[model samples]
Each structure stands twice: as structure tokens, then as C-alpha cells.
Target: MKGSFSISVQNNTVKYAFSLKRNITIIQGDSATGKTTLVDLIREYEQNGTDSGISLSCEKKCRVLEGNDWNSHLSLLKNCIIFIDEGNRFVESKEFASEVKKSDNYFVIVTREGLENLPYSIEEIYGIHTSGKYSDLKQVYHEFYKIYGNFNLENKIQKLITEDSNSGFDFFNSVSQKKYICESAGCKSNIYKKLLESGSENVLAIVDGAAFGSQMNLVSELLEKRKNLSLFVPESFEWIILKSGVVKDVEKILEHPEDFADSTEFFSWEQFFTKLLTEKTKGTYLKYSKQKLNPNYLSDSIKNKILNLDLLAFLQNSVQ
Candidate 1:
């Protein structure tokens, strides 16, 4: 529920080894990539144990969730790692998201369709990769690889785009300071459209990486086609503020947020960061508000502190 879990599952034919840390992990790839095969192995191991010729190893219980009675099946699980194969239509529903928000379990979902209702991390999206056979040559080796790599800006940015309509947008818009255009896409789902419509030669789109999983595939495809586009995805604006050293005694928490962020309490790391920032800054000059950024955050010292952080330091020359 809070820590990472590594899983090793295999039969005589193939082996899969991977680790999942967040509440939601997405596995998606073209056909014949062993996406379904991995799930099948898990199901087989669960149904027949070692007798099924399949071996599954993990610290936590691993099982599959499916069928029309998924809500019931999910309700009984706790502190588990659940696997849901593709074709589980319930995974796309608001009902499933609601349940996931309340469940104390990690999910490894295989699907080509985006689950907008679920606030999963873009970093958690992965695809299967086959890398030859095992030592015995009896089992094929399979592993998970991140579908999207880190985004870095090699060229100067001429414009800024945000997925937020309020505080985040306000902060970046203020940073642009009329030198460059900064616009908000209004929401995460609209970021791609704004990018498609943005004809600028150099643009940087800022978004909440913690909840941007649903848009990664499509947006990444567009990124491949457009050389001038760049993405700057942090956990959230609140996370940026906390990481700025504006908050005291937060180094440990920032280093490993998973230790503090619980699955049931927070649907995504962004939500946890929002709550953490709001609570830590309450009744102080640095008080946080998502509806509108506190003007104090725009001050030279605070602004410089934020921009000085390594993750955002690149924006210093652009904003100036």
C-alpha cells in the first residue's frame, strides 16, 4: 500500500520480472508482446500453484480482478497487488476509479485504452520487452520498460502551456511575464488539443506527471512527430513549491514520497502533495491555495528559490 513490491513470475516457457511502487501501473504494447501472457501466468499460478508448472513470487498477494462482480471482488482485497488483463471494461468506469481510490492495493493493468477516470502516474506507464532466453534456454525473458523517457529542453522555449486553470497556470503565467505567451489547457485532457493548435516553433507544456498517465500514449506520439514541442511534468505545482525548500524539514518526505503517501488516502501523489503543502503552510505567509497562488510565491526570493531547484533551473534564462 505504501512501499514498492517486486514480482517474479514464470513458467517453463517464459519469465517476467518487474517491480511496482505506485498504486497504479499500466502495461500496454502491441499484440504478441506477452501482455496477456503475463496475466495468464499469474492466473495459472493462482489457480494451480506450483503444481501448475508456474512459479510466482512476491511479498504481497497477487491476484486478478475481473467479471461483473469486480466491486465485490475488490472489496475483499487489501494490501494486495491486483492484475487486471485487457477486456475488463469496468476498468474504464468511474465506479472502478472510485473503488481504487478507497482500496489498499496496487494495480498492474494491461490495456490499450486510456483510463481517464483513474489518476495514475505517467512514470508508471510501461511496455513489455523481450530479451532473449533464460540460462536454461527453456524460458523466454520478459521485463517492463518505461514507455516515455524524461523530457528535457534542448532549445530555448518561446511559449508555455499548462494543464491547470488556476494556481499552477497563474504561477507559470506570471513567470512568463509578458515575454512569452503562457496559456492553460484548462485540464489534463485538453493538453493535447492545445498543443495541436499551438503553432509555435518552440513550446514547453507543463503538466502534473502524477496524474498524467492517461494522456501519455497519445501525447508521446505527438511528441515524436513534433521536434519543437517539449514537456515539463512534475508531480504537481504544490510539489514544486515544497521542493523549493520553502517548507522546512521536508527533505526526507520529498526523497521518498511513497513512504508517506498511502494508496487509500490519496488517489495520486499530486493529491497528497496538495494536502501536505496546504497543511504545512497554514497560518503562514507561504499559505497554499489551489484556487489561486498566494502572491508571496511570486516574490523575487521565493520565485528564485523555486527556479533554482535543479528540475526547474533551466527556466531561469527563459523567464528572465
Candidate 2:
């Protein structure tokens, strides 16, 4: 019933595997590396009668919970298998982890990163990587289409990369930014809607700031609507900060003394942004596509950006 699925990339091939027991399974990987695909596959197998029912009677029984709603679903853990798309979203809550420990049911958590500190009894954890081969890329794309029903622009952009080897780097850069737009249009739209209705004048939008591209679009929308909004961006987002055209409105607000409280600490955005851009360009060729980049390098670059951002400090000061 409950299981975990992963596909390991080695020597240009992907080796897929799944668990056989009704135990907690954790699938960890970076963004766009198919963590969600594995979860959907397991959910489908369980629904189609191919997998043993670990928690629910039918495969159609899986549910998604956000915020406090996760607590209500914890009760069903004994008879239902819960698949969390972004497991890290819940890791900050001790009460949630406590409830998870008290539950006897199975859960399969899929996250961009692993959480070793959580209290749940995880039976197994697996890491998946993106495939390097064009054939594998096609297969993954097809699988993605099957699950999501239709291919979006991000899929089309990736497909373009697969078709033209010479355009890899350019396509990657363009698509990476476009992919952010795709996600912001869909995923972050919910958060935007929530903010619009919450009636809060001072709103804090916390995100994986260095995520770049579409993620920034989400922040842009939030900042445009909420005059008193503050963004908790990763340090790497300094690239956008330095890029004069990207966030002009926000920069203007920060510069004008009359626009914000005197307590607001405004700094030289252009200087910090330029420094990050220079450093990143010196380290890696801009022609490098994420698909072609070394996984360790990619992970480290992202993690360092997050760690150096002092995100909590920004959140504390921004959130009312």
C-alpha cells in the first residue's frame, strides 16, 4: 500500500526502484528531477490494484493537505497513505511532526531536500537525479505529460533542448526563467489569492529566493499588490537585485525615504547584485545548462545561496 519510488541517474542511465512494504518512504531530489513523478507512479499503482493497500482501500484515496489541515489527515494515517509533494513545507512545525509520530499510518514524503531531523519513523529514503541522456529525457517528459494531462511551456522548452544540442545553454537559461513563470502562474497563484483575501496590510512572502525565474515573478506580483509587502529572498537573488530592470518598483520604494518607515534598512542593491553575478559567472560558464551541470555543484550553489541569505532575519523584520 505505502511505498517510495526513486530513479537513480548513473552513467547516463536512470535506474528506477520502489519499496515493497507499507512503510514511510522519503524521496529526495532537487527541483525538476522527478520526485513528484515517483509519488504519482506509486499512487497510480496502488489505485490500479498493482500495489498492496497499505493505508487506503483504493488508490484514489490519497489526499493533499496544507498548513493545519495536515493534522486532520493524520488520523487517516492508519488506513490511508499520504503523499506530501513538498515535505519540507511541514518540517518547521513541531506539532505536525509530533502528530506524525503518534500516527500508525504510512506516508511518502517527496522533497527537493531531505529532512533528517523529523521525528517520524521513516523506513527508507532514496535519492533521484536527473537523467543525462536524450532518450531518458524524452521518457521522463512523456511520463510527466501522462500525469499532468497536458504539456506546458516548460515541457515544450525542455523538449526544445532535447531536440537541439547546440541550443542547450541558451534554452536552459530561457527555460529556467520561463519555468519560474509557469510555476508562479500555477503554484504561487494560490498564495497570491490567499494574500488578497487575508486583509493583511503588511504581508511577508517567504520563498526559496535563489530559485530565480518564475519564483521572482511570484514575488513581483505580491509586491505590486501589497504596498507594505516585504520579500524574504535568498542571497543569490542579489543577481536580480543588481539587475537594474528586474525589480525597479521595489528598489524605488526602498530608496524613497517618504515611501517607507525610517527604520527600514536600505542598502546598495546594485553593489551586492553585481558581486553575485560576477562571482557566479566566474565560477560557471553561462552556457551551462542545469541538465549538463554537475549535481553537487548545482546543489551546493543553491544551498549556499539559501544559507547565506539570513532568511529568518528578513522574515522576522518583515512579518507583522
Task: Give the clashing residue pairs of candidate 2, or none.
Answer: 1-52, 1-54, 47-59, 55-79, 55-80, 77-105, 180-214, 181-214
- Each prediction's total of clashing residue pairs, residues at least 3 apart in sequence or on different chains, is 0, 8
Candidate 2: minimum summed lDDT over ten consecutive residues — where?
Answer: 139-148
Local distance difference test, candidate 1 = 0.83
Q: Please list the C-alpha lDDT of all candidates, in the order they appear.
A: 0.83, 0.37
lDDT (Cα, tens digit) per residue for candidate 1, span 152-250: 445556888899999998888888878788888999999999888777468778888899888877887887788677777788899999988999988
Best by TM-score: 1
Model 2, 253-296: lDDT tens digits are: 33431223111121222223334344444545332222343333
